[model samples]
Target chain A: MLKFDEQKVKENMEGALKLRPQINEVVDQIHERGFSNICWLGIGGTYASAMQAVVHMKEKTALETFYENAAVFLTTGNKRVTKDTLVVISSVTGSTEEVVDAVKKCNEIGATVFGFIDKAEAELATLVDHLISYPLNEQLKFFMVADRFMYLAGEFDEYDEFYNEMDQHFAQGIVEVEKAADKFGQEFALKHHQDEIHYFVGAGNQWGATYSYAMCYWEEQHWIKTKSIESHEFFHGMFEIVERDTPVTIYVTEDSQRALSERVVNFIPQICGNYTVIDAKDYDMPGISTKFRGALSPFIIHAVNNRIDVHIEKINCHPMEIRRYYRQLDY
Target chain B: MLKFDEQKVKENMEGALKLRPQINEVVDQIHERGFSNICWLGIGGTYASAMQAVVHMKEKTALETFYENAAVFLTTGNKRVTKDTLVVISSVTGSTEEVVDAVKKCNEIGATVFGFIDKAEAELATLVDHLISYPLNEQLKFFMVADRFMYLAGEFDEYDEFYNEMDQHFAQGIVEVEKAADKFGQEFALKHHQDEIHYFVGAGNQWGATYSYAMCYWEEQHWIKTKSIESHEFFHGMFEIVERDTPVTIYVTEDSQRALSERVVNFIPQICGNYTVIDAKDYDMPGISTKFRGALSPFIIHAVNNRIDVHIEKINCHPMEIRRYYRQLDY
Candidate 1:
C-alpha cells in the first residue's frame, strides 16, 4: 500500500514555495562563483530533476552544463577552482552508491561540490564542502520542492519574495493535482474499451509532467509502450506513428515552447493521421509556489504524475508492480 | 520523381574519406587560433555530423566547444575568439542559410571560421577566411558522403594510411548496405499488421543512426507512431512505458557502452513486455574500416533502415495515404 499523505504533498509544495528564496540565495553564490559549466548529478527521481535542471542551465547560458556522475569529479577534476566548471549533486536518500561514489570522487579530486538533500547531515553532506537540504515531507517522492528550489538558485535574480510566493502556490497546487487525478483517473482506467496502445507527451517545461506520466504508465501500471520527446523535435520525424483513435495526451506550457504546445494540439489529427488529444492545460498546477516560472514549468507538473501511475495500473488488470527496473547511472 | 545518382553514393563516400584527414590536420591548426571556446555551425546532415564530431572532440581532448546556429548567432555569439574559442562551420549545400549566417557571425566577432564543404567555389567559401572543400559527388544527399567522412574522421589517425584503408571500407560498406536492404526490405514492407508501435533508440556514436531510422519509419513507410530516444536516457523513467509488446530496437556500441548494451538487451524483454534487438557486437557490419570509428556506424545501419522503408511502402494496399501535404510541429 502506498501512503501518499495529502498533507505531505501540501507541505512539500509549500516548503518548495517557502524555501524558494533560500534557493535563490544559493544561486546568487553560484553566479558569483563564475563557473563556465555546471553539471548537476543525482539518481532516480532526483536524477530526473537534475537532468531537467542541467538542460535549463544549458539553455540559459549556452554553456555545456549536463548531468554527470560524481566519478567525473575523480577524472575531469580541476586542478584549480576557476570560473569554468561547477557540480551540483542531489540525492533523495543521499546514500545511493553512485551519488556517494560521486561525492567521494569530488573529494579525491579537488572539485567544487554543492549538494541538495533532505538529510543535511547525510554521508554525502559530510563529503561536500557546501550542502543544502530540501524541506522533507513524509512521502519519499517529495523532493520536487528541493529540485525546483535548487534550479531557481542557478537561474533567476529577483527571487526576493520567491519563498513566500511558492508556499502559496503549493497550497493551491494540491487542490489542482487532486482535480487532475479525479478528472482523468477513471478515463485512464478504461483500457479494455480503448485501442491496444497508449502514448504520453510533455512539451517544454511539461517534460517533468510527461516524465511522471511514464512513471505511472510503466512503473505502477506496467505499460511498456509510452514515450515523450521534447515537443519541438517531434515534428521533425516522429509524427507518422500516431494512429487512428490512439489515446494520446500532451502537456501544455507557457514557456518558449508555448507555440509548440499550441501546434501539437491543432495538428494532432492532421499529423498523427488519426489520434485524438486528451487535453490537460485546464488542470491548474501549483506553479506559483516555488515562484516556478513558466519557462521552468516542468517542476510543478510532476505532482500529477503520481495519479497517472494509478490510472494506468488500475486499468491494466494487473497488480500494482514494477515490471521493469531502469539503469540508474553512477559516478 | 526522385533522382538518386547510383555512383554519387560511392564518390561521396570516397570524398568523405578524403576529407577526414583534412579536417583532422586542420583541427589542431584552428585550436591554435587562441580562442578559449569552440562553436560549430552546420545545417541538416552537416549539423547532424557536427553533433557527432563535437562529442568526439570533447571526449578526446576534454576541451569545451559549442554548437551555434545563425538565427540565434547574435545571442549565442558570445565566446571570446582569443585562442580559447574555435568556430567550425559545415554544410553540404554550402549555400544553406545557417552556414552563411554563421560565417557572418564568426567574422563579425573576429572568431576563426573553419568551413567544410563539398564544392570548392561554393558561397560558403567566399564567407570564410579558412575553407576546406572535398570534391564530393553533390548529386547525392549529404547522407552517403557525410557518413563516409564522418566515420573516417572518428576512426583513423591521419598518418596511418587512412585513405587507402577507407577506400577499401567504402567498397566493403556498399556491399554491407545492399545486403541489409535485401534481408529487411520485405519486413519493412509488411505494414499490414498495424497492431504495434515502434520506438527506435541509439546511444553514444550510433545516436545519429536513429535519425535515418526516423526517415525510414515515418517518411518511407508512413508509420506515424515511431519515436527515437538516446539509449542511455532510455532506461530511467522512460523504460517504464515499454508496453506489453511494444517494438524497441536498440542501437549500441561495443566499446564504450558494452556493459549497458548487454544489460538493455536483457532488460527489454521483461519491461517492454515485447522486444527485439539489432546488436552491434553480434552483427557484422563490413570490415572494421579502422578509420570509420563509431559515429559513422549509422551509415551501415542505415542500409537496414532504408530497406525497411522501401519494404513498408511496398504494401501499397492501405489507401489512407497518411502523408499530410504540410507538416506541423504539434497538436
Candidate 2:
C-alpha cells in the first residue's frame, strides 16, 4: 500500500461513472447519424485499449469493428474507412503526433470521428467531430461506447441491466479489487523488480492489458526490459526460452479463452520456478454478474496492474513519470 | 553463411516456384466455389506469415480477410467466419495440435478449408478440403494465394507480370540476397551473441518477420531472450528503455510504412551507438519491378535473416533444430 492513494482512485472511478449520461448522449447522436462500420484508432497504450474493445465486439456482437494503430493508419490509410465509417479514437495527452495526424486523416476521408481527450483545449478535441473530455477510465469509456452501439444494434439484451449493476457496484467493486491486489503487487515488486527481463502472458481481451502493462508501465515507466506474449503464442516459440528460474507472469481471465492462459499456467510452473498468476477470479466484483466478468476482465486486470506499477515505482526508487528519451530529446 | 547451403536454398526456392501451377489450380477451385471472406489461420511462425499476407490484402485488395491465431480461433470462434468463409491454413508438421483442432472447427462450421502441409500424409492434409504438400517457402505460397485471388477479383492487374518476373528472378534473386547478407549476419551474431537481450524493430509487412525471428529463431532455437517491437510502437514506449549501447536491429522495408522504420533507423544511431539496419532496399531482386519490391520485402528480409540464424546457430554452437520443450517434452 506504499504510496497508494485510496481517495484519488475512488474519485477517478466515480468521476468516470458520472460520465455515463454524456457518453450515452454522444452514442445516441452516433446512432442517429448512422455509420456503416466502427473503426477504433489509437497508438501504444491507447491502441492496446482499443484492441480490447474490438476483441470483445468480435466475440459477442456482429458489428464490423476495426482496430488500427494510429501511426500505421496515418501512414497507410485503411481501405475500410469510408465516409460511412465511425472512427472512435482516444488520447490521454490529446497531442500524440500519430493520433492527431490520424484523426485529421479520418476527417479528410469524410469519416465521422468521435474521440475522448483528457483536455478540452487540446488539439485533438478541436479536430474530432465529437469530443468528450474525460481524464480517467479510458477502458471504461471505450466499453460504454461499444456496449451502447451493441445495445442499439439489438445485439446486447443485458445492456440496461449490466450498466445498472455497474452504476451500483463498479466503483466500490474496483476499489476493493485494488485493495485486494495491493499486497500481492507490493510483494511481487519486492521479489522481481530487479529481474533482468520479465515475460508476461495473457489471453482473450486481457491480452491488451498484458501487452500495455509490459510496454507502457514496465518498460516505459520503470525502464525495465520485458517481453509480452499472448498465452497461446507463448507455447509457440517463447516457451523454449523458459528455464527453471525465469520470471514469468500469466494473467488468467474469466473469458472464453481462459483455458488458453490456464494451459500456460499449468505448463509454466512445471518448468519455471518463478512464475505468478494474476487471476481476475481471485478479486471480488461485489454485485457484478459472472456473465459480465469476461467483458470487464480488462478493467479488473488493469486496476490490479496499476497497484503493481505503484509498488514497482516505489520499490525501484524510480518515479513512474521519469523518461529518458520520450519527449526529452529530438528523435 | 557458416552453415548455409546455397544450393539447397536454390532448390527450395525453385521447388516453391514449381508449385505455383498447383497453387493456382487450388486457388482457381476456390475462386470457382466462391467465398464471402478469407480467413488465414496458423500458430506461431505461420500465424506471423499469415499476418503479412493479411496486411498486404488490406492495403491493395478490397477482400475481407481475417488473420487469426489457430488456438484462439479454435477456442473462441470468430463471428466473421461462416460456411462461405475461405479458411487458408498451414503447418510444417501437419500435426500442430491447435491448428488441427482449428481446422476441425472450421470444418464443423462448413467453411471451405485449404491448407499447406510439408507432408502429404500429415493430419492437416487429410482434414482440409484442399491440401497443398509444400515443404518450403511458406510465405511465397501465401503470396501466390493472395495475389491470385486479387488477380481474379481484378484488384491486381499486374499479377501475371509480377509472377512472370518472379519466375525469372526470384530463385537467383533470393540466393543473391543471402550471399549479400552473409557477412553482415555473421558479424552481427559474433558481436551480439553474448548480449542478454536484443531488441528488434520493423514496420509494415516486415513486422511479422521481426516478431517471428525474435520468437522462433532467437528464443526457441537459441534460447536467447529478446523483445520484438513494431517500428512505430518503439517510439511510443519501448524507446524510453533503449540505452546508449542497447543492441537494437531495425528492419527497414520498401513498403509504404518504410518511413516508420526509417525513423527508427535515423533516431537509434543518435541515442544508441550499437544499432543495425537491415534495409530491404539494399538487396537486389533481379528483373522484379519496383512496385513488387514492397510486396516482396518480407521474402527479401527473411532470406537476409536466414543468414543471421545460420551464423547465430554456428557461433552459439546450439543447433537451431534442438529444443528442450517443443515436441521434446510433455508440456
Candidate 3:
C-alpha cells in the first residue's frame, strides 16, 4: 500500500546514483541475451520510457525494439508471443492489466522479460526475468522519470562519461523546464498548440521520443491532431503544406546536433509555419551529453511532457489528468 | 502535357487495375538494395515516395532506407553520400531542382541509382541503375513521386496472385475513395473536418499511408491540423478523448480487417466523434485483398494523395482546381 512522494521522487531522480547498478544489470542482461526482437510495453510515462530506451538503443538494436500497444499485440488469439522475443514491462505501478497480460503471454510463448519497476512484489514483476527495482509511483513523474531512468542506466551500464553528462544535464534542465513551463501559458502558446494539428520533429535517436512524448500523448490526451516526422524529411514537399498557421515543434537533443536542430528551427519562420521548439542542450540538466543515446532520447523528451501538458491544459481549459473510468474496460 | 477530366479521372480510376506486382517489385528492388544500405533522396511526391518506400521497407531491410529531404539531399556539400550505397530517384517529371541535384551527387559518389520516372527521357532517367517507367504525367501526378516511386517495389517486382488482388483492390479502391470524398462535405461532417484540423487513422502495414497521407498532404495542403495513428493503439487510451467536436476518417483496407474497421466506426458514433470511414474493399475493382508488408503499407496511402487534396478543396470552398503550381520541366 506504499505510494509515491513528489519530494522523495524528486530526491531519487535528482540523486539517481543509488539505483545505478540495478538498472545497469537489467540493460546488460537484455543486451547480453540479445533477443533479436523486443517489445517494450507499458502505459503513460512507463510506455514513454520504453520508447525512450528503444530510441537510445535503436542504433544498437535497430527494429528489434517494438513498442507493443496493449490492445492489439495479438495477431489472432491467446497466441501472442514469439520465441525470439524479449518483453520489457515498464510501469510505475506495475498494475496495468495490459502489461500484465502481455508479459504472461510472452512467458507462455517462452520469451524472456526484462523490466524496471517500483515494487518487486507487483504482479507484473512475477512474469519478468530481470526486474530492476526503482522508485516509481504517482510521484515518479514529479521526480522526473528522465533523470531517474538515465541515471539508473548509467550506474548499471557504466557509461561513465554519458552518466556524468546526463547528471549535469538534469540539474540544469530542471530549472529551464520550470522557466519554460511558466512561459507556456495557454493564450501565449497552448491556445495556439491545441487549436491546430501539430507535427513533432526530431532527428536520429530523438525521433522516437518525439513520437511518444509529443505525437502520441498530445494527440491522445487533447484529441489534438499531432503527427511526427524526423529531421529534413519534413521539408520534402511537406514544407509546401506547412502554412504560417501550422505549428511544429522540434526536439533539440545536444550541442553537436544543435546546428541541425537550429537549421530546422530557423526554417519554420520562413516556411509558412509557426513553431515552438525545445532545445535539450539548453535545458538545465546535469550532464545531458552522455545521456544522448539513439534509443534514449525519449527520456529527454519525457522530461518535457509535463510542461507541455500544463500548457495544453491551459488551452483545453481543463485539468491535465484524465479521471474518467465511466466506461468499463472493454476487455 | 495532359489536363485532367474529372469525369474520366473518376471513371478510369474505376477501370484501373491493381498494380500490386509492379508495386511489390518496386518494393523488392528497394528491399534488395535496402539490404545493402542505400540513401533515398527526392523532392515533392518523389520525396514522399522515398519516405514511404524507405519506411515501408525498413522492417525487411532494417536500417538501410534513409529519407533525405530536398535541402539536405540535393544541396549538401558532399558530406551525405558515399560509394557504398545506392540512390533511388522518383519524380514523375524528373525535373525538380532538388531531385536533379540528389541524383547527380549519388552518381558522383558512385552509388548505384534507381529511378521511377513518368517520362523515359526525363533527366533523372539518366542517373540510375534501373528505371521503372510510368505514364504518371498523363495519369495525374507527374512526379510519380508518391504513386510510382512509393510503389516501385510493389509494382515492379515479381507478380503475386496477392498482388493481382491488390490491383483489383486499387481499381475498386478508387470508387470507395470517391464515395468517401463525396461524403466529406456534408454539413454535419464539415462542421468538424473543414474547420481547420483534420485527422486520419489506420493500422498495420497501412500505418505509413495513413500517417503520411493525413499528416503530410492532407494536413499540409489544407493548412489544418491533421493526424494518423495505428488503430488498435488509439484504443489503448485515445478513445476517452473522443468528443462530439472530433472528426475522424478510418481507412479500412482488407477483408481480414473489415470487421475491425466496422468496430471502430461504431465506436466513433458511440463516442460522439464526427467520422467518415472508407473500406478499400469497397472500391469498384474486385477480388483483390489489401495486405500489408512491414512498413510498406504507406505506398497505397501515397497513391491517394490527389483525392485527398481534391476533396480538401471541394469541401473548404476553394476553387475546383487550386493551381498552387504546375511544374514546367527544364528537361
TM-score of each: 0.72, 0.97, 0.69
- Model 2 scores a C-alpha lDDT of 0.87
> Per-prediction TM-score, chain A only?
0.72, 0.97, 0.70
- Listed in order, the DockQ scores are 0.25, 0.76, 0.19
Q: B-chain TM-score, every candidate?
A: 0.72, 0.97, 0.60
How far is A275's C-alpha from truth in model 2 (Å)?
0.9
Instruction: Give lDDT for model 1.
Output: 0.52
- lDDT per residue (tens digit) for residues A53-99 in model 1: 64344334434555553332233333222335566776656776657
Q: Tens digit of lDDT per residue, candidate 2, span B265-331?
A: 8888778888988999999988998988998889898988888888888888889888889987775
Model 3 lDDT tens row, B1-331: 0122556654554332333345446546655555344556665445545544543443233233455655444422323245655566666667766677767777877777767676789767877777766554222221122334434445424334444454445444444444544433343334553555555767543554566565445545555556566665555445555567677778765523334455676667666556767555443433543333222223333334455555556667654323232221111
Predicted complex 3: DockQ: 0.19
Q: Give the runs in model 2 whose Cα sits over 4 Å from its true position.
A: none
Give interface RMSD, every candidate, in order. 6.0, 1.1, 7.9
Q: What is the interface RMSD of candidate 3, in Å?
A: 7.9
Task: Indicate which candidate wins on lDDT.
Answer: 2
lDDT of 1 by residue, B220-279 (tens): 346556656656455545566566666677766643443444556766766565455655
Worst 10 residues of 2 chain A by lDDT: A1-10
The best candidate in terms of DockQ: 2
Give the Cα-based TM-score of candidate 2 against the true structure. Answer: 0.97
Clashes of 3: 69
